[model samples]
Target: MKNMRDKNSTNSGFTCANCGRTVSPAAKTARNHCPFCLWSLHVDSVVPGDRAADCRGKMEPVALFQKRDEWTVIHRCEKCGKELPNKCAPDDSFEALLNLTALQQ
Candidate 1:
């Protein structure tokens, strides 16, 4: 059997480590970060949902960018300093995204 942490089975709800919010999985995509704080755990090493990483660090949202109409959130691992970008979900907090944008400007 495949592990629950594997790429195909990682779409599950989790509590936000940064904001303490009880987050639900995304409706159309696999939820990887806290929508409220835009924080994530460093669980994937190569690809999103892979769960192959062993660092298990807190990924902090540090930047934001846009490509066409989609917005992406950049997260940096606090423990290892690895950075990754994730696409914004439909339900992600607009206020949090705005804060990131302000910091970039």
Candidate 2:
């Protein structure tokens, strides 16, 4: 059986470590971060949901960026100083996205 941490991964919903929100997985895709606070964990190495990384760092939402007309959130690992870009979910908080985008403007 998978352990508690393994069970509560991107495939399943889990409480957010940054905002303490009860985040649910995306309906049709893997939930990479908390929709409420836009925070993520440093679990994936080369691809999203791969779970091959062992950094276990707290990913902080830093900014909003666009690629091919799609908006993505920039996450920075607090422990390792690595930066990654994640697409915004359908149910992600619009206010949070606006705030991050505004900062860049």
Candidate 3:
């Protein structure tokens, strides 16, 4: 769970398992994402930051949120209860994504 945060702020990443988009890290931190299916590797090393985790988990999209300005994707571990936020990808399935949002609403 080391190096889990950018600026030590609860650690975060741009391309997490939920958003398979290719992303640019702010600097040198690890960018999390599969760049295809948006499935995350079980990286339970930091709760949400750092590549220190050995879990290398497969993060599955479970929920969605319609914030004032952003639509955050909530992902739950296939093996754990941990959750994280993910930015939507352009290639994300519109139908599936809409269904997820519909259920949330």
Candidate 4:
């Protein structure tokens, strides 16, 4: 699968499927995950925002990992058990990221 570090699509914000929170667009890139809850959908297969995957499973944020100075969110698909790491957006909740990291300790 092709790994896209930055999502370059311009799409409208979506409501969170996990927490039912209204999520706004990231303003700079495609909002693949909900910033409020840090949850994502299994929509992309090869490239980010490609929407080629048919799993459509609810992706729960399992953990957070850092590469150098950047943080990435690790999501696990509840339906298909697929795991993917997503690049963190600038406005993503810091507290939520902290909580996810705390789980690893």
Which one is best on lDDT? 1
lDDT of each: 0.88, 0.83, 0.56, 0.83
Residues 1-105, model 1: lDDT tens digits: 233345557888888878889888788888889999999999889888778889989999999999999999999999999998888999999999999999999
Least well predicted 10-residue stretch by lDDT in candidate 1: 1-10
Misplaced by over 4 Å in model 3 are 1-38, 44-49
> What does the lDDT come to for candidate 4?
0.83
Worst 10 residues of 2 by lDDT: 1-10
How displaced is residue 71 in candidate 4, in Å?
0.7
Q: What TM-score quantifies how close candidate 1 is to the native fold? A: 0.91
**Cα-based TM-score, every candidate:** 0.91, 0.87, 0.52, 0.86
Query: What is residue 96's positional error in candidate 1, in angstroms?
Result: 0.2
Q: Which stretches of candidate 4 lie over 4 Å from their true place?
A: 1-10
Candidate 3 lDDT by residue in tens digits, 44-91: 455444455555567776787767876667766777667777656544
- Scored by Cα lDDT, where does model 2 land? 0.83
Alpha-carbon runs more than 4 Å astray in model 1: 1-8
Best by TM-score: 1
Q: How does model 4 score by TM-score?
A: 0.86
Error of 2 at 52 (Å): 1.1
Compared with the true structure, what per-residue lDDT tens digits does model 2 show for residues 13-76? 7778899888766898788899998999898887787777789799998988888878899899
